[model samples]
Target: MSTSAKDIGRLFSPLQIGSIVDCVEPLSAGSEAGWALELLAERPELEVVPIERDGAVLGVVSRHVLEGIVESAWKRFWQKDLDAYVVPARRSVEATDYVDRIVAVDLADVEKDDPGWYIVNHRRAYLGIVNLRTMLEHLNHLRSLDLRRAGEMQKHLLSKKPDEDPRFRICFYNRMAHEIGGDFYRSTQIGEDRWLVACFDVAGKNISGALATSALGAIFACFKLFAYAGEAQLTTGLLNALVHEVNPGDVFVAAALFYLDMKAMTVEIHNCGFSPVLAFIPQENRKIACKMARPNLPPLGIEDRMVNDAPQLIPITPGLRLTAYSDGLTDMTDPFGERYGEERTIEYLRTLHKSSQADIPGLVGTEVDKWIGESHLADDITLVDLRFL
Candidate 1:
């Protein structure tokens, strides 16, 4: 509903215990107390994990634990090889752990005075004290307005299209490392004889990715408007021209441009880094048919090597379905750390064809989740299926 610090805290607080977070800086559990002080000053929010050598708060340090290590100061610790330090964890506490009192004692009575704080187990392992104020501020910062807007944009991006039976079915999904990501897709009929279907992924995460994707979407919409004018159809030249108009960098889209000619039963395709364009003909017993397409050109803005490449030709016979997809579908990793690679993807397509169903997008999503054993898809997944009946 609302993006707020409390929402984030509630989501993350429960998982805080045993959560192994990397140290933002490095600290040491040694005589160099300045290192600990510096780390504490820089990141007061994070609790330091203190190391205990002979059962004392040997001193305090963090995991990155060495942010205070200047290049000049490295020779001191580098010589000893005692650079590694882990925090002394908490064990148990006594009645005086949370108690504070002003005791009247002689200066000499300090010999037996144990001004110890909270103890872990029965011994002293230092779990750095938490800074409540800093923690709260960090939590509140996450509830800012920009994050909320980005979340809303992602919702709009992922919104389902209205059910309709057109010439093709196009569906898209993006994992978006943050509130925004780079993946985008579009389908448009350029003219009576040509159609354009495209999918692309920008290079970064969050706002940069969203901006790049938005730019591509704008380009797609403008091209679609031209196509809708019925003045000139989208061709390789037109596609290249639109790309040339956009400002380079922050955007890299791996897309495939398809030009379908129904009368001639032919399809012309410009494959730009998108892979596994599986063509299945029902008359061929739904067997997976590979089109002899040209090698993928380099992605946008990286190199100018793709200025001219031969378009691959494929015969779009009757009762055939043409499918092209992005790398996300194949780059998925299962729970066992195994990738659902291109080979497995093609096999899945053949199985779907074997079932002979009018609706395949929904089925494709199901099969992918089943293979991965979870619905938590980490990449931007897109699939475009065109059935020429």
Candidate 2:
């Protein structure tokens, strides 16, 4: 099925893109061929891509590709990872080509997406099949219709507009994921002497989480307009009101809101139920990690009441940096299922602290992406970093 640029937006909606898996690894190709067949039987609509060998495309297996190869001998011989099966590619396309070509052609006509996937080569090689879902996602973000407008909306979300402020710098980098995530950030003056900087994440990914987050931003903006808070009650009340507006099953937002006292060089932190906030101190050459006491209340909307009524105030020192992020940072699994959890997070933060580079946000962001390697993100990631100048 070919779709025009005009229709691509509807095609890549959260519902459609979420339906496709980035890649799937089948059970041993040489052993348990019967089991593999049974697996495909359960998910008949899924398209399967075989691992490539040397320079040849092997395995024509899809959910239905193995129905005919049900014999015991076939299953036993081909069940081994690469030994049993050797399906060669009859044809292939370079990844760097154009999108219109693929869209104009029927799915049966072309072996890949409109342009296909491209690697970082002078002459990039043909890199596997372009499943239907990936093609639609690529077009939805960059297609002809309202491309400029989409850029502006993302800019507004990130608050990256050039004229917003010259005193502070904010940088946002999203390395082309399937959906827009829950990372929301903002900087505004709450009092003549105080400025607020926030970095937070909502649960889930794509539009479902994005809608809740966008609404959360609206709520904060409304609160800022009507009832600005120097008091914990006001802040928690606003959080309860926002939570009450959303449905019960929705994931909650974990955030750290800082009211900076520039004159005193101090800040007050409200640890609503989220990950424990870490304060990185250079003098101690170590971190002071703070955890809110348990009996900790539910995050934001759970009961429309502050779960933990006491406010924790920590002293902020000059030359010390504050790192706040959602669980996505610590919860990511290596392809082997090892988590890049709190221990690694502190280690990485320490390494960056010693470095002479000044762009803290970008430096930490880049390292996190490299750590994940080929493993895709399962949730939205938002990191808010503040360093006193």
Candidate 3:
């Protein structure tokens, strides 16, 4: 059976241009046009034939031009030397060049009417010819496959549902700027009355960001195996150290970790270069009060040791609602280039708390949609809302 297009793409995806180079015996100098015509007639597949002199490529002549010359009653042209009909190669590229890079840059200028063949050489020696059109089609197929797999991996990272609790309700909202992004969140119930809710934003985007989040997920899973107690500081320190160890110096994670204890009526928050955590407290006067918990430490993976000594503790009331989000929400810009500033985010939360809306995350997304209009998001967005019932 013949190899399919998908198989060809997969087989040659990681190779260089030399891997796909076509080796056709070239015509030597002083050859007549009739010899090239006869060769084309025999193969019936070659679109262009190369002419070589002293082991160096002179240029190529298309079958269409040769056929036109013969049909136009130019009998003397066939007897003439082929050198006069050869079109000098416009450009030549090294065979060692990566197939992907060639498709991305070199083939960008190739047109349908232009000759789709490229002269490939290695160490200043002509190796063979490469069909730009075929290479582009194969690489495009490979890219599509890779993007689909990355999207699936991202979906798997966010597949788990938040832990269920009668005493509290949790909701999450996330949207990636691309098919894969850096924003992620996790919820784990360690005790009957204690729950850990965390959100992270990796400094990288696309595959790099997705890979970092995957590492975080593995670390979190290992942390869950230990017995549960009030060790938020130690856990945060361990996470910081591991993140720093796994990623490069420039890559870091902005995160917010919330440890909720229904029994103690308190929530411990650790903010590391993340957006402020909003706390809405219900007052006795039948009104709502809002408070902000700003970041107290640098982002994770930036230092060998955790900077913040301890987390900020907030008293949790029956009607208290805790909201945490990534900076993408506040930093998002409109089509006219105006940011949806932090002040607007705070004011919107205050108004949202006063209302009886149950779907807080959904409402926030709708409001953001209105603010951005048709403009695409520049970063990933994630928002988590927790309410003490």
Candidate 4:
């Protein structure tokens, strides 16, 4: 739940303003008016053309203005000076100006108060004028295409729910944002009463995060395969080691791994910079807090040395319900600019505990939806709920 402004910024990156350069043509002021007509004839797509000199954009001439002036008295008023038509490069749009840089604002989120121009780079000595109307139209087209791809990605990545078990009631939900994201979970039954429940959030978004999560999934298969292959090693150290071997970079994942043994009535958990595993067991007069005892475990695949604490042990009693969720839930923000954080999550669990319900995960999601006021999830959401019968 320790999210940052950078986190939300990554999900909706904008298109570069320099991408519109193809619509402009640079020319020198010495060029004859006939050359402008030739340029227009050769490329009729451009609305306005800039005339440059010594690597600096000095002025521009638009076809609309050029057509109007040429057919009017200006042709006679400046019959001797044809170069008088060139005008200074525009520095204001709707009377507002902005510095040049890679624009990181999402096109859909732009406001009427925003500046009409953005310079994407300084590689060129001088910046040119921009047709704000045409640029925004292009952005709208790209946004439609991107949303379509995101929809397909969501359908392809959401796996079918595993079969129901008589020993435990399981409810799982995964919701992708408008763009593909890096949140996933897995549930594996190793034996009659042995299961592994894992959920992780890769510190990435969109295509990069999706690829990283897919690689991590392959590593997870190796772990599950080895466990059934009789060389079983269910340690966070092993997970950390495998990631270190495959991924030696700045990126890492927040994960919580749980091993449930019904026969022994115990749950062993490894919390690697992941949110504490939350569980509530109804006792005669009080609610037991089975949240991970150590909450400061470091995330996996970061430190060269082992940072995750050893797996902690917890005794399980009858009527125990637990929930595992990604940081997306806690990062949910409201219209009032408040995050639906851990404190509210704990309070929800307390309420669910009192009700003794089986749909803890589903209700938690509903609570978040009500708080955020929409189904358009800004971040990926994943949740898992289990109740020991």
Candidate 5:
């Protein structure tokens, strides 16, 4: 694919590549292989460079290629030239064929997209080069412009706080370590004085996990119709099967689902590989850890078999508050690199309970912020506190 000088000039005008044009020097084929190897060794960052002769590109040569060529074809490569060992660069981008090396895009098509490197040629003759490193930096700059907008959308997807219910009350807190993360929770109300809460944490921390949890959160929005949260076995098994079939990865979602039966005065909890659920009873004057009915069962996407597992039942009497949260709280690191583990978390809860801090969820978030001083949070934080009247 050849380009006329007029077409090439038009692309240069659109790309404005003048600022980045002087970053590299293309090596000519006639140059000594020994000197080229020395230059490569001096600048460890430059793995490969363009090889041209008579203003025509032969191919690219890396340190490995140069060394291997010298070793295998000793007579041809070790003497003075790189002709025998210069391997062709595979097409890494939208490049045209007719090449000894990869030509990501021709000058005529440069305005179409500039994500990868381009072969700047005029009438099929090599002009200087447009490199991949500078192009990728430009692409990343363009990509970062939209992350704040995406964060706003993530915040909007969170379920509303539940305060209007006559039988029970809930306070929720969620904070992302990064601009967006995989932490999410949903609370729904079914009729007959019943309610449900499901807290989730996807496997990873940043953009990839955020995307997975965002999609999973959408599937969970279907439960807002009012009955799925309390149906622990059906909800867990269905979500397990659904995530296995839809999500394409080894990563899984760890969740604790709680179903509150105001009529029966019982809270049925399903803890699938999540941090423990703390039961705060003012009457008992202690925090009871309802760890899980089956602690060894894998997270939502591990195996295809989970029929025998069931939710644990606890009597829901006056002054009983059930708190479920993400592992981020327990695993939070201080500036000194010490972990704020389970013991600290439980003690914090007991202290708050003793002090009669009515809003435990909000106070817990504040404590986490104070603990993670001067150090960035390692994961997303989530907390859901359900107090039965």
Candidate 6:
């Protein structure tokens, strides 16, 4: 079978500066400047030629420098040794170094008059040369490839849909504003009749957010393997402490946790800095009543300890539906600079509450699509729906 895109992304090798190193032949320091000028004229691709002495690369001579001397009517200077015109290769790097590490090096320290090139070396032995511009372009290409790989991995994690159950129906929709995002969700069966569903959003966008979400996924996986009695409040507290320990000071997680106990016929909702959980109850005369269970605590990773707050409890009656989403859905903006605010979102959900044939997540996506028109999403969007059978 042919490998898929995700497999191809995972198969990519780590990029290194050695991959771009150019093994151009070096010129002897005793070579005449006229000979170097002739060599440069014959080969237009040679931007800079390295000067060597005693099997060691000393410096480089550019074509421009040679032409400048010739244009100034210095015919006698052309026969002199290239030692005086050699420009020292101050920026040198090991060939084995990762391409990403180049960002940490101070490019501003290099003299503007010197040609932008780096001498590639291995164990203090000169290997080849790498042009500064070519290195930067290679770095960009590597970053793009790495981002696409990350996006694929994140997408794979989110693609796992909850198993079909006889007790309830669960459906969700997720769309990243960029190649990767901070929004994520998970569903796990903790017991024969107990199930846990969670939605989370990490602060920031792209790489920063993606990094935090990756940590969140790892924590969740570990929590699933070993949890104490599968208690919602305890799990939330543990998640908070662990998230705080793993993430940096600037990063935090907004989450909504729903614990479903089929035997007890109830749901316990723990909302921490996330959007309110919307509960819909079918009323008389085909009317629908909606209740909002707002967040009771601050976001995770903001503090080492979770506050003493009780999660909201609701009876799991038939025809009752629960919805949870990330703030990205409400923060979506139109071309006219108007937000698809909470009020509009709630109002739109009300219309879907009475329609039994409606694909809830699909309808929500359609409405947001219409509202935003051609404008891009301001952040990652995620919506999850749980309905009692």
- Candidate No. with top lDDT: 3
In model 3, how large is the Cα lDDT of residue 291?
Answer: 83
TM-score of each: 0.56, 0.54, 0.77, 0.62, 0.64, 0.79
* Residues 260-376, model 4: lDDT tens digits: 777888877767777667877666776566553334457777865565345577676778777777778778778776888988866765676654344655676678779888534
Q: For residues 103-143, what per-residue lDDT tens digits would candidate 5 score against the true structure?
A: 24433444443333444443354553445555556445545
Candidates 4 and 5 compared by TM-score, better number: 5
Which candidate, 1 or 4, would have the higher lDDT against the true structure? 4
Residue 69 alpha-carbon offset, candidate 6, angstroms:
8.5
lDDT by residue (tens digit), candidate 2, 1-389: 12222242332332222222232332444444456666555545545535444544444455434544565565545555642453433334443445445545634654543323211111344223444446566567555345455444544767643112333333333332344656666766655556666656666566555666677767667646864645444655566666666745567766666656665556667655666666665555465443332213456665655644555554556555665666777787677777889778767766665554357657866776777778887765666555554
Winner by lDDT between candidate 3 and candidate 2: 3
Task: Write the candidate numbers in order of decreasing lDDT.
Answer: 3, 6, 5, 4, 2, 1
Error of 3 at 336 (Å): 0.6
How many clashes (backbone N, Cα, C below 3 Å) per candidate? Answer: 15, 13, 0, 0, 0, 0
lDDT of 5 at 270: 75
Give the higher-TM-score candidate: 1 or 6. 6
**How do the candidates rank by TM-score, highest first?**
6, 3, 5, 4, 1, 2
Residue 336 CA error for candidate 4 (Å)?
3.3
Clashing pairs in 5: none
Q: How does model 1 score by TM-score?
A: 0.56
Off by over 4 Å in 5: 1-134, 159-164, 190-192, 225-230, 284-297, 308-310, 354-362
Candidate lDDT values, in order: 0.52, 0.53, 0.80, 0.61, 0.65, 0.79
The per-residue C-alpha lDDT of model 5 at residue 170 equals 72
Model 2 misplacement above 4 A: 1-155, 161-177, 223-232, 247-249, 263-265, 282-297, 356-358
Best candidate, TM-score: 6
Ten-residue region with minimum lDDT total, candidate 1: 98-107
lDDT of 1 by residue, 75-142 (tens): 44563312354433223232123211111111233334222222222123232332223323334454
